[model samples]
Target chain A: MTTKMFDRIALIGIGLIGSSIARVIRREGLAGEIIISTRRAETLARAEELGLGDRYEQSAAEAVKDADLVIVSVPVGASGAVAKEIASSLKPGAILTDVGSTKASVIAQMEPYVPSNVHFIPGHPIAGTERSGPDAGFAELFQNRWCILTPLPGSDEAAVAKLADFWTACGSNIDTMDPNHHDMVLAIVSHLPHIIAYNIVGTADDLETVTKSEVIKYSASGFRDFTRLAASDPTMWRDVCLHNKDAILEMLARFSEDLASLQRAIRWGDGDKLFDMFTRTRAVRRSIIEAGQEVDAPDFGRIAVAKPAEASQGRD
Target chain B: MTTKMFDRIALIGIGLIGSSIARVIRREGLAGEIIISTRRAETLARAEELGLGDRYEQSAAEAVKDADLVIVSVPVGASGAVAKEIASSLKPGAILTDVGSTKASVIAQMEPYVPSNVHFIPGHPIAGTERSGPDAGFAELFQNRWCILTPLPGSDEAAVAKLADFWTACGSNIDTMDPNHHDMVLAIVSHLPHIIAYNIVGTADDLETVTKSEVIKYSASGFRDFTRLAASDPTMWRDVCLHNKDAILEMLARFSEDLASLQRAIRWGDGDKLFDMFTRTRAVRRSIIEAGQEVDAPDFGRIAVAKPAEASQGRD
Candidate 1:
């Protein structure tokens, strides 16, 4: 406890991920000093008010100076600008990383601007809540979650190890994969689901026969489940959609094609197909629960205080 | 408090809805006697083990005999058979209803067989979990939820009032709509959501680009949200799909159309369109939360014990 993981850690954005890192770093004594920088003055002031960092810098370049580690947690679309802004100030031998969802694009954006001495390891800690801002973070956001580090080939082994160890201490287990594979995997697992959630919510919102009040009133049936994902931050999701366009498009095409087939089955009243498809999906959830990637509680553990109206009752 | 809602209530299917009704009847002392019946002897035996009813009957007709109220909680496809079996055995002027999802189909199925003397009011308590069988039922299953009734024209008003009072006592607000309207409303709110969820899960499972293990491992991201709805009772949902074909197809068509537009926007990199669509949907979830139909807690109140990995971290 006497020794910190880094002499100083600079966070270049203080939203959910950055603030969570700050809170965890403070709680775990991971750094001697935390330097926070964000684009907006209001957000930076809020982070300072929350004591998220020992020092607040208006310029990301200033924040990275003398810091042993720098985490760029901005929107992926803004990664290039942030990298360019802070490139000259990054200390030699400092470990630089990002918590962007799309690794290939982030690497594409930031890798060119990185100095030769700086270790630019692209890492994504697969943990967070839907809420944003400095106040929305807690120290335990990464506990028992996976932190995937898509380090470039031939990167410094010791730097990667150090970053992995730091994330482990932050409460995440480490996994490594190719950046493209991460994009494909995340497109299916995260991007497609979020897009579908947003699309369905939009669809439900546009209905004329079904009142919005009716939709909200009776959301407990199944609609409420999608609403959670749809309620996520728009700008972040927009950046994600833009940054991971090809992968997301590929997944969306597949989803739409599969949906067309399912639509055919429903229109034709193919009960067997519907039953088999529905039955097969049940096991994925079971596997997810077994893997500890999800809660075992029915209805996301909300049934104890369930208030969803017009739920689909089970069969006899 | 001393007076029961019904002298005797016959539950002709001891699954989620039927068993929950039985449990609420016991908890609230709404019925003098509860007669549980199902197609399977094992289910009836299980219901008996759970003490969900005062007496267990293999034959629904036998169960409905001398009963003042009969609730057919079978799948929509089986409503006709259940109504036929119990029609002749129903006590004169007894109240008969159902908890089927598709009201028009259930009414069409059960109406022909119902005797004139009995009040054949079709109903659906828009409440349930993905679980099935007698053990899944809880007394609070319908608490603060909506139970919609679609009564045929010229039906006895006093009988309707009594049924409404019974559901109210069991802790559900009452909604009355035409069978066709109920189908349309539910098609968008419940049926479409379930279908889309099932389709997405199927799409994820069939992907050669992403392994099933990876999907499950990273499900806490956004995919896990859909898996809960996808894990619902296959038979019940299959029946819902088959029985509500018209409305399901209608909503599915609309959903597909919206999805196609969203797809176009994504493919074209129309950030403004995507942002606007995503922004509009956020209000629906907020409205749902304010309406008490959804958990206001982020991630469906699961973050207190969040396990989803690869979560989309918020913006800077």
Candidate 2:
């Protein structure tokens, strides 16, 4: 087992992300004692059954009393409440962070409640499956993935680095950015995708001509990818949508406008325009594959990774 | 080695879907002599280099000559042209099929050109990856996927069964549906998802406030899924949009309308409505997972085949 990074780590909200952290911390021996807390008694019970931590507490405040690090892993909308609950009990010099999808709102909700003595840093690990609850997490989930730390300006660098080192030990590459910028960036990347997936899936569900059975049957033709995204934890996504309202709205506006142009092109039979836009997007997929974000497949990320770069070069 | 189902099989076009077909066909020994053809010479050479076929031909007419089965694997727009080109040269009583995404449009485009003696069936294997070209072909790509065949009324059942058996051997479950129904169903299941993904990616690319670097960095949140869908083969998707115009437009209209309602719910802070929608959508995801269409992961198809009984239980 590895050396512990903290004497105790308190996890508030033991859902997919939180449970994952618990598993990773346990696997890597990052914390001497891990405390798991959640608002839902049932989920807390489930977390306990899963043996996710060394201690279990019904109250977030109670969980953080003696912790050297506290990680808030709740829906973005609940960050404020969680922070408010744990603020007074947090040990001075303890590092406080979160795994919320929207960083700006999380910071906004969490910053005010944090005590001046504690080192509060905001973070979001860019890794998770659509599955939720404590049972959905595993130790290897963060392997080769990114963990973004949205440290507040003037925050303690040592505290931030410690958290970064912890995540790195959990098998993630760490990067730092401003909380607001991280929120805006995520609005386009993660937020908009879920909204679009949810919107499209909902739209299909309501269609009269294309019965639900048919949609399910024929989903392999590209619709299934969106469903994967759409199938993501609704509470988490809804909270993200509500919390990151401005950035999401801005991204949605731009998306709608571009879609209109694409619609116009299709309506007018401007195949060239459609072709150019479609062609340019393919390069991005290549970059993503190179970045190890996706596998090299023809139309979706369904196929396995290519054997070697040598086998992939210039064959097509 | 597996027994070859046909003495000779001709494949037209060598894009993502087409190449995958070639890959699976070869792996399953569905054809004794795989004859590959494409409009582009470069693509044909690439297919040859990948060892995708026994014989590569630049002319569709020559490729289909004496072949026991002919598979047209081109964009929906090119179905008619390919049908016409190979009409006279196709072996009598052979099974001739096209794997275009849209059924009605493909039937309309190719039916008039097909010879009276050959069995012409429209088939779509609901399998593909985001990468294209001959290099993207893989033998196991169609494992446990769906393959829908829209055979015209009064077409030979023996021919249909033969094609079904072929795809079954290639690891796809077979389903039959009306051409028009296939178009409408696919519009929701495949076309709209691609359109939304493309539109959203294009939107993010055009944004000034959210720099491209930011978009790329935080893409793991959700936008990356859209990028994967958006990065699909442009020609194939473009043809799908144009050829399945009516069904696509109908689906798009429904999507926009539903999105408007969702937008309003968010704007008004209707948490109950949001929660209800989120809750309902969550069940749909469960059904999909049960149906084997997805895994239990929160992000992608991480647990696509988890809980086999649950996945298979939702079959129509």
Candidate 3:
């Protein structure tokens, strides 16, 4: 493990990303003492039960006091509130960063509250599962994942390097980009995909011709892949949608236009057009697999086991 | 293993599904001899090299000459031509089936050419990976997966039972439904998901705001999952879209309407609506997992591996 980079590191919002940070900090000995805090009492209690930190606090303001580094990990919508809550408590010269999905909105939300003496860098780890909450995190969560840091132009280089070191110790590869550019990239790669997944699942649920049970039964064919993203944390995703409206809307418009063209191809029996489009997309998956972004297994290497009793309900 | 279901089984179009059937039939001793055929010479040669069948033939007619069971596993659009090519050569009392995703269309395409003496039953196994071709097949591909049979109203009961038995021996649970209903069920569960995935990937590729390298680098966030389905067999999916046009179009309309509402919710910052829609979709995924239709593990149980050299190319 690396030598402790900070005497005390406070973690605000002990949800999936927060708890993951706690675990990694502890695993890598990145901080001499870690303080965990969240708004919800049960979540705080759960983190304590899991022994996720050296100390647990119910108040973010209390958690930040005396910390050399503070990482805020909350829903994007709540970043500003958390910043306001902990603004006065932030230690001078401390590096304060957030693990929110949207960087531009986060920088805007927290920058006003951050003390001029403090170094506030906005970051996002482009990695997650469908699950949420304290129990859903592990030290290995960030391994091989990209953690993008969108630092302001005038930010202190030394503090940025320190924070980058902490993340590097946690097993992430770092990339730095402009906050607005980060938002646009994530809009297509993350936010839009989740939105599309949620929309499709909602459509299937509301279908009058096809029963819900049929959708569930036959999901393995293809639909289940979309469901994984749709089942992500609702509050977090809702906040993302609200915070990154322009980028998400722009990406969504492009997606719809493309869908209309594909729909026309199917309707008009344009097999060549469909074939060419489908063929071109295959290379993207290959590149992802080759880049080590995706697993190189069919169906994500899912193994079929005996059917559960619930499976019988859907069968005729 | 079960008693030999047929003296000889002819598999036409030895791609993912066809070669998989060949492997399972060999594994289970379901047929005394297996004959594989495809219009493409290289695929037939590869199937032979893979030892997928006891005999190989370039002509579908020759392949089914003395086969007691015949499975046409080509694209749905090719069902008619394949059926016509092998019709006169099909053995008396032989059971003929196709594993096409779209049932009504396949039946309509092939039923007119089937001889009165040959039993024609249209079947669809709701199992596959994004990977295709002979190299992608596996013996256990159908294990515990649902296989639906949509036989004609007056199809011989014994013939249907025998085909069902053959699938059972290959480790599938059987469900029988009307061809039209099967088409509708599949439209929402399989066709729409593939179409949406293909559309989104195409959109990302065509984006001017976000570079292709950025999308590939940040894909693990969510976009990577869609790419797997998007990268599926172009000919097969194209045929599915064209053949199941009515059901697909109907589902697409519903999907577009739901997406519009979701887009509005995002535009209006309707957190409650977004949260409710997102929350309801989680239950569908849970049900699928409970029904043994999907793996319960997070991120499809993918293990994070060391980043490959190619991954560095996309980084700034």
Residue range A56-93, candidate 2, lDDT tens digits: 99988999998999999988899999889899999999
Error of 1 at A36 (Å): 0.9
The per-prediction tally of clashing pairs is 6, 26, 0
Q: Which stretches of candidate 1 lie over 4 Å from their true place?
A: A305-316, B1-3, B305-316
DockQ of structure 1: 0.49
In model 2, state the lDDT of residue B144.
79
Clashing pairs in 3: none
**iRMSD per model?**
5.2, 6.0, 4.9
Better of 1 and 2 by DockQ: 1
Q: Whose TM-score is higher: candidate 2's or candidate 3's? A: 3
lDDT by residue for model 1 (B277-306), tens: 888877887788788776655553254443
Write model 1 residue lDDT over A1-316, tens digit each, in one string. 6648999999999988898899899988999999999999999998888788999999999999999999999888899999999999999999999999899999999999999999999999887666677777777778788889999988999999999999999988899999999999999988899999999999888889988888988888999888888877788899999999999999988988998888888888888998898899888888987997876655522544332121111000
* Per-candidate local distance difference test: 0.85, 0.79, 0.88
Clashing pairs in 1: A126-B310, A220-A308, A310-B126, A311-B126, A311-B127, B220-B308
Q: In candidate 2 chain A, what residue range of length 10 has the lowest lDDT sum?
A: A307-316
Model 3: residue A170 alpha-carbon error in angstroms: 0.9
